[model samples]
Target: MDNKIIAILCGLLTCFHLSTAFATENGSDSFSLGAEGIMAGALPPAGLYFLGYYQNYHANKFIDGPSQFYVDANAVVPRFVWMTNHNIANGQLGWYVAQPLVDLKVKINGLNDSNQGLGDLYLGTMLGWHHQNHNWLAALETVLGTGDYKTPSQTHLVRANIGKNYDTIRPIFAYSYLNSNGIDLSTKISYSWNSKNEATNYKSGEYFAGDYSLGYRIQPKIKVAVEGYYFKQMKDDKDNGKDIDFKGQVLAIGPAIQYANKNWSLEAKFLKETNVKNRPEGHANWLKLVWAF
Candidate 1:
């Protein structure tokens, strides 16, 4: 009986997931939008809810295929998620969207360059589920990236790049568990399927990424946590029938906080990239607000 109880407890406590990865220049991140926890953690009966998400990302250095350079890049993304009271497979269903605005300046090989523009458009569909007692919640989602590639805004002096100019279809799974003793764990996992960039004739490789968090509820309205993410490009990039060889990996970790009540939810998190290869190193900050009726 003791062993069985221990096994059950471990099973209940040790499950997690993450997000997908994509391409970007210095100071730009379409991935790791500070998404943590379970979107399906709790299911609202039947109604409309609003979710507002914001992220500020900056990168100062990076490695591009064996050459390192200095870059000052910043991207701000404002996103919205709409919730519906409808149900599917015992879960709530919804859709969400966003567009990114970017400002980037690079001092590479001794040349100063910069560009600012609206990067890309994003869309997704979601299904969320919550276990009884609010101890566990899970979500499954499909997100699409439009071919935002290089439009006029993407064609700046030096053709400064904000959008990667490719299409992506990624599936995500997220879950969270809170123990009776106030221990909370949440995670998400995703795999990205990528399409070619018609402008550069370059097709970026697909990648996998995830976010994980552990925290303790300190008060009825607040929980403090440590959060992190990891990204890995699974294969080589291709350009015009040739290998571009731009696969890389990234890892980051930091602190996070959440405050919630019956009608509002607010969360903030900061992450610092500590390990990277074949990509830029940077930090990301996120703020999220939600209102429900």
Candidate 2:
């Protein structure tokens, strides 16, 4: 394998689900399931909700330092989420659970690795508010993940790993605003902190992510939007207490469409990475269906 490819893999150890950062083989969200857009703060009627989502990510090439390497990496993540109601902090409280199934493949330089299996279990509780008169909604939530799946060894150059191997805390703030004019805006920001991977004794750096959407509702059941997100690492990953100078970042934007009825909602978005460092630059796509019960 080329040294540049090695650097690419090593440089992205923190890319997995965004635990202390979410962890993944490609990256978080696109691994951890964070950074949602469009009506992120909208509160539904008090009841049970179920969501099914799928994402396909393809990045065939990457740049690291002054070297660029060829890669043909693709990942398919299927996720399911369940949320229900309660009351907390004088606001409606909702608790949710998410399970992710991941199929990842990579071909970098002349080496290849693939893995298909269960990822991590994510759970969270949120307090949500909707002011109908003001057309505003807001939510505060804390997400947590269990690291009980596949983890790469410390000496791996490339491996098929589905889990980050560290417990993570992801706290989030979500807001949205809409008016009679059909204009709408939504944003969500989340920060993650991860515990050390005792098996490898590696500590990924903390990270911050922000997602936004601007849209216009053409009708009560149809909408179009522009969606984008930004991610930045706050510090360097550590190996047994040694800083590794491998912070990473990326930005993406694209268009989206959503259709909703009384009981079901469907959404699709396409994002292209506009800028990146020590990471892959390519296209990511999302398809989601949600139903209220």
Candidate 3:
């Protein structure tokens, strides 16, 4: 009787670990949401700028599965951009690199695990154009899977890795219309292509994602807005070249406020997730700082 009890307990524990991994494998990806809001399509003048971001995310419910699974993640990312004097088609040329340090934790059925390390590296270049009241931006970004990742075969029981162990390529486009009357509209769109995880023979699907914001300047240096984002997976995941049924999607919206001066700006936002599918239902809070240096 004692032996049987122990065996059953071990099996149940294993199931819980697999379930946790399932939550991450199907739903989460390399992209970070809520990274931009107030000036989604605007780039600063030709100079070097430093941007800092902090995000806190928490989820206690899962769609299409048990609600007991919980996830909490925090990240701090610092990005540097340099816009050069050279112009491309009447647009300023710029390049940037971002590195993120992430801490992630998950709990299910009273079992919990955590991981902390660098998440990924972002390398990109962009061109920004401006008209009287309109601004446009185009960029190419790449995600390098430089974070810590472990294959199922390498882990003792569960994979609590913080990285995806795959490369991703993306193209971004943005537009902004800022009216002198204090009304502003902005949007940023991007599509990603993920490569196969050779260690596990699994490949995630392609995804389309973007951010949108509408704001009214309450004062000369203050603005308030409603901001949101949408993500849709366009293809099915695959394992060993065969398709998997899981495809995740989500939409989130929230409030944002910003204060800006000639050389620096600060922005804060909170986003609540809804209409989430094949993923964890979560909310995120973000704080950003940008300075011309």
TM-score of each: 0.77, 0.81, 0.90
lDDT of 3: 0.72
Q: CA lDDT, every prediction?
A: 0.55, 0.57, 0.72
lDDT of 2 by residue, 217-265 (tens): 8887788999877878787777777887777688889999888776777
Best by lDDT: 3
The predicted structure with the larger lDDT, 2 or 3, is 3
Please say which candidate is ahead in lDDT: 1 or 2: 2
- Model 3: residues >4 Å from true position, as ranges? 1-24, 153-156
**lDDT tens per residue, model 3, 152-207:** 54334444566778888888888878878987688888898988878777777888
lDDT of 1 by residue, 12-51 (tens): 0000000112233222334543455423233344445555
Question: How are the candidates ranked when ordered by lDDT, highest leading?
Answer: 3, 2, 1
Q: Report residue 234 deviation for candidate 3 (angstroms).
A: 0.4
**Model 1: lDDT to the true structure:** 0.55
Q: Which residue segments of model 2 deviate by more than 4 Å?
A: 1-35, 65-85, 133-157
